[model samples]
Target: MKSKKEKGIKYFLKKLGPGNHYPKAILYLMLVFSIPATVLNIGSDIAGMGAVSNLLIPAIPSFVFSIVFTTVLTITIIKFSYQQIAGILKWLCLSVLLYIIVPFFIKVNWMDVLKHTFIPTIKFDQDYIEILVALLGTTISPYLFFWQATMEAEDVKHKIKAVVVDKQMLRDVKTDVNTGMFASNLVMFFIILTTGIVLHGNIKDISTVDQAAKALEPVVGKLSYVCFAIGVLGTGFLAIPILAGSLSYIIAETFDWKQGLDKHFGEAKGFYITIVISLAIGLVINLTGINPMKTLVYTSILYGVTAPVMIAVILHVCNNKKVMKGHTNSLLSNILGFITLIVMTVSAVMLIYFSLHH
Candidate 1:
């Protein structure tokens, strides 16, 4: 007999997706509302801690600069096309390596660290595996996908609404690859920042999403948690809407329903209904009160397991002339993307094999 908890987890996993546009108003409200409260709350937590030693930690300004650079790249994507996005992403991947592998040179016995890092001794890897599994899991993140796809839809609808009023091809909503890649990099940047901070120094396990929320405080420092909270919680509002919306899009597209953001809410009842159901289900995830960190870990592992097929689909979509048209991946982009694909595939296989062996 399945427990009520198992049933809730099943429901949350099954429905979270996005379809049309993420409700911007909701995201704005969350950011505006959460920052002050989160800051005050963090202040209270800090005040309770009996030492100034904890407060001594500082956010590496270089990390902040990197984030800013990523944001600029995002702007470039929106302004340009897929070709430019690929060039930027290749550079970003190089930077990603720099971020991961470079910092050890500052203090550690470089040769000894390299011995441990490259040799990958079995005992050391057991602790490392969980974090790697969690981080790699980002590839199939439903929140980001829902955000990207629905934002693509939002771009389309914005253009459509403009066309309806002005009667010209004011904008095109053809799922810009640059925009998608830009968003993807930004996400990867933050995850690396979080994981790199902990994994390189602390090497602790983050078994949940709530822990992720807290980890930022130590990394970024101070009232910035409010900003972090706003970014996440606010984004969650956007994410949840997309979560709901993706399900709606998939359902509507499947049934050939008249589904689009351009349609009024009243006219697109099925779309709205699907969105509502998805959000309600996600809300249930929090309310059911399972440890969010554990929920996030399990979800991450699931995503890591499923990522290879998703990568193949992405490559196919990028390659298909009918889908991507002039924005097909360049040779270098294709090569690097394939490398990323292989790495993820290998990781998935390792994870599966380890599970089975255990």
Candidate 2:
């Protein structure tokens, strides 16, 4: 016979649905906004890279590349099994190495870079606040939270039948989640480092991802341009799937439809339809003459607004013995979680204040 605690936890888990589906609904709304932003990111990457490629090779126009890229991406997602795509994501990690390498090739003011990184400069202007919000949104995205949890659920579905996860399993989950996040931050760090050293004040504005890459040209010549351009394409290829797949997962789980990337289109029609709709909408946004970089930054603000609410719930769950059992968060974990919540809250509030006043 189960104890009252056990029964209550089971009921709570049921209500949460597959991978905390209820909370994920909020994230789905954010993803809906983010899908267009991601589409813009993809378009910008292809255009930026294609333009640079054409300057040297003069083989094909950017629109041709964009069409081919999207078609190939769609076919690959629909045709390949989940295991195959996982293999491809691993290869895409190679693109991040370019960002790390770029800094080594360029001259950097080490002292100023260290000061800005460690000391931080406070700016209160609207543009600065918006960028801050965007950075926070992109860094700790809601899509990642859903994707990570659903993925862990998928891994165990094949072998486990129990409602409870063991401490070791939870530890493994933490390790896996943190590893990806660390790599993401590392890549972001270097990209900024490269840009600051090579572009910074040199370029008044970066309207596109490719333009940001192109700014590296003067420092390392055309090779920098080519490398950065390729890097953008590779990163976009890696990110779009996550964006599209997260949207599919959230909608499917929310509606109780069968969902898995391993499943064929016929087996998971609703899931695939969700992906298609997200992609189509994103493409529409790109064709509407909206600035992709601006779109991306604005999407971050949407994420900024949504993330704290999600994080608050997550922190509650993590701290709850009902949810985590003996694996409930450690003191340090709770402290860090609160710090994150506070920081995000402050940023969100500042964003609102600045927007209203402006």
TM-score for all models, in order of appearance: 0.54, 0.85
lDDT of 1 by residue, 204-228 (tens): 6665444544655554555434434
Instruction: Estimate the TM-score for candidate 1.
Output: 0.54
The pairs that clash in candidate 2 are none
Taking the tens digit of each residue's C-alpha lDDT, what string does model 2 give over 31-86? 56544445455454444444445544557765555566666677888888787887
Best by TM-score: 2
Q: Residue 65 error for model 1, in Å?
A: 34
Candidate 1 weakest lDDT stretch, 10 residues: 44-53
> CA lDDT of 334 in candidate 1?
91
Query: Judged by lDDT against the true structure, how good is candidate 1?
Result: 0.46
Best by lDDT: 2
Q: What value of lDDT does candidate 2 attain over all alpha carbons?
A: 0.71
Model 2, position 247: C-alpha lDDT score: 73
